[model samples]
Target: MSQPSDKALVPFVSVDHMMRLVHRTGLEEVLRGLADYIEADFRRWELFDKTPRVASHSAEGVIELMPTSDGEVYGFKYVNGHPKNMKEGLQTVTAFGLLADVGNGYPVLLSEMTLLTAMRTAATSAMVAKYLAPKGATTMAMIGNGAQSEFQSLAMKAICGIDTVRLWDIDPAATAKCAANLAGQGLRVVPCASAEQAIEGAQILTTCTADKQCATILSDNMVGPGVHINAIGGDCPGKTELAPGILTRAGVFVEYPPQSRIEGEIQQMPQDFPVTEIWEVIAGRKAGRVKPDQITLFDSVGFAIEDFSALRYVRDRIAGTDLFHPLDLLADPDDPRDLFGMVQRAAPER
Candidate 1:
């Protein structure tokens, strides 16, 4: 038999190409597809090898590494959260990620994840909403209208059937940009002046604010019964969005308890605080939305499995598009036993 043609190298996807992939497929389609992948991963939760995220922090910001494996494949992303960077015309966060074949510890792909992170984050939030939010929920209160606002709005419109979004941001310009970017997405955007005004009469409340400290964007008094809270930005230790009282009254749900307890809104509660893990609910081992009066909280710290799903989803959608680029991050030896030879082949010039 003839030897197989040299397999094409792994594609390296850039921010520009990824955005096109997202735009062409339509945001709703992407969210719907991504939710399926995320939910599938949740069903096979036991199949995954997970670890708490690793973080390196400075006074200005935090850089995190989230890694996970499903025996066959492994992936990780390097992401930073710096709320102050935007003032200097830099992104508040910058990211890149890699997917590897764990069987050989070889990197198969590299891609810019800054924009991808926004997409994945919104996708994950919508996934939780589909399973936890009340049926036929069409209105959402999106707190913090910054870089993530447009993506969250798009995801909700695409997956949750949300046709109207109530937007609130401390900065009016941020809200304006959010509305402007989302023009003609087939949703009604209502800009509000305060957090309370935004949450009014909305079934879903998404807090994607970037304050680096514990700030109450939503108070206990503002939250009503049956509202699904998608808390996205309270991901780091000191950062939070909901008041402590709010968590106490809600039937809190988290992605991973151990990591979430340290990083989620549950951190404010006692060590023995009762909360449901979303995977159990998705697997039907636990109940979700048992009552209309139940205030469900998805304390989203943005888990690794979600990122795994996103990377996999992007890979499939952009397969033949040449939207990705390959990086020489791993070694492929002609002979498996010639490890030394591979090292010598890659040595620096004399």
Candidate 2:
């Protein structure tokens, strides 16, 4: 067999490799790095192609294709959300993604994105909290303790200086799992019996449930003044975590207003319901949290640009490291127009 050319290769990061990469750079540092990249991209938000994720929904779950390009590089992620998978001892969410050079349309990076998604989601939450959470905030209420709960807790601790996390979930085992994972991570972990107890004295409230329906994991009555709400589980139509009244009372910030209106907490409200893009706030073009007593909400539904940023970050991080495998994902013919000839020439080796 003949060796393939360099152009035929693509860097692939597996789940194991992703974990190693995270450990190599240090988890908290990687979280901070992702947050920086995401924030930087958001500051130049208008330069990218922005659109809602293309989704295929069914009774079982939904599969989505989130794609975007910053004129130089194009990236996309294939992710799925199936709430019932947990009962069957499977992951509720799973994903993989790719980044390509737009000039040549050749893939540059391919990576498993299930774990990356969790990390970026938490980083984004913390980044937004850093901008909107009250001054000197140190405690956060983690309203759900599932696959994403621990990451969310650590991200807040790393990025927002949150020293304590109050956790609550419908399932006690989930809370126990999250707590066990968080041990010795430097934060005071508190397990609560109810969602109401979790939010007590918590300056930041993060709700990340897995259910695919319109579930009110955080009610208006449960929320108090001067808290930043990070609602991430409310993704896709009919899936939400915050109450309608809460949206009405808070200053809602979103990644992209068009996508959020269809898939975020605002889906429960009227079409004309107002929302401020977090990029505007980050860019100093709009206000984030004006008053100490005012409520702030980051209605995050996982935008494509964030994934693009993650792909970009991963590509840079794995530059000289063995944390990624080189995959022969493309056909590199000696002559660009000789694809058929190359295939025909391969019959002898077969």
The C-alpha lDDT values of all candidates are: 0.86, 0.93
lDDT per residue, candidate 1, 124-243, as tens digits? Answer: 888778888988899999899998888888888888889999999999998999989888989999999899899988999999888889988888899999999999888888888899
TM value for model 1: 0.93
Q: Give candidate 1's whole-model lDDT.
A: 0.86
Cα lDDT over the full model 2: 0.93
Candidate 2: tens digits of C-alpha lDDT, residues 1-350:
47779999999999999999988899999999999999999999999999889999989999999999999999999999999998999998999999999999999999999999999999999999999999999999998899999999999999999999999999999999999999999999999999999999999999999888899898889888999999989988989999899999999999998899999999999999999999999988999999999999999999998899998899999999898988988999899899998888777753
Which consecutive 10 residues in model 1 have the weakest lDDT in total? 1-10
RMSD of each: 3.2, 1.0
Which residue ranges in model 2 land beyond 4 Å of their true spot?
Answer: none
TM-score, every prediction: 0.93, 0.98
Worst 10 residues of 2 by lDDT: 341-350
